[model samples]
Target: MARYNSWQNRSLIRAAEALTDAARWQDRGAFFGSIAATLNHLYWADALILARLMGNERPQDTITHSLTNPADWQDYRLLRRRRDRQIERWAADLKDAELSGTVVWYQAGGATRVTTSRALCAVQLFNHQTHHRGQVHAMLTAAGAKPDVTDLTSLG
Candidate 1:
């Protein structure tokens, strides 16, 4: 799981870096408007799920709050680097026992629900990242930017 997390983070970072040459803040038809916004959403969603798993208060009120306008490529890259480090650290320190426990939390819509385990929550977090990143990649390509290779084996 840790290995997969590491690879996913690296893959996300690489893809984001590849788009640096394109417009960083311009809306390229992504749901979040721009690459920066889409990537920010991805990071925030991961953090939100991680926080829920650990019984911590979410920093953002809504997932939409995570959307951002990082006009500078360097700043966007730095933020992504930090997020990747956070993901790596979380994955490294995660315990097998914790993965099996139920996570009870309130949904953003104010509904209460219980997750069976952190493992499943973690899977959702990573999967969410991939799903949105794919959207950003398509927007990048449509905007005439060359997206990074997305194959998992290539990431290895």
Candidate 2:
């Protein structure tokens, strides 16, 4: 799944390269409002979830900042690449015992604490990526940028 995440991200970034920055940032009325915003949200969410799974401090930026922190598209791409590598390394080091454990985290924007299966957290990470990427995929296609095949079987 980590490899798939990285591969799909690379494919999307490459496809997005054909568009000008203005086009990528232009509002298309998706959940995050634009391709750039959606990608930013995905990156922020992934980083936070991974931090929770690894018992690290959450990033300082709030959800609102996700759209503008790495303001430049090029910077976003570079950070996303680094994040993908971190995820891959985490997956490689994971042990069976780790998945059986639980992960506890505070609800976003609240003091309430939540606990869930570590494995489920991992599932959310990949699932969230796929969900937003699908949005980006549609937006990209509508904008005339052809993303590569998304099949997991194509990972090879």
RMSD of each: 3.4, 1.9
Per-prediction TM-score: 0.75, 0.93
Per lDDT, the best of the predicted structures is 2
**71-107 in candidate 2: lDDT tens per residue?**
7988999999999999999999999898887888776
lDDT of 2 at 88: 98
TM-score computed on alpha carbons, candidate 2: 0.93
Model 1 local distance difference test score: 0.66
Model 1, 5-48: lDDT tens digits are: 55654555565565554565677766888777787777677667
Q: After best superposition, candidate 2 residue 77: deviation in angstroms?
A: 1.4
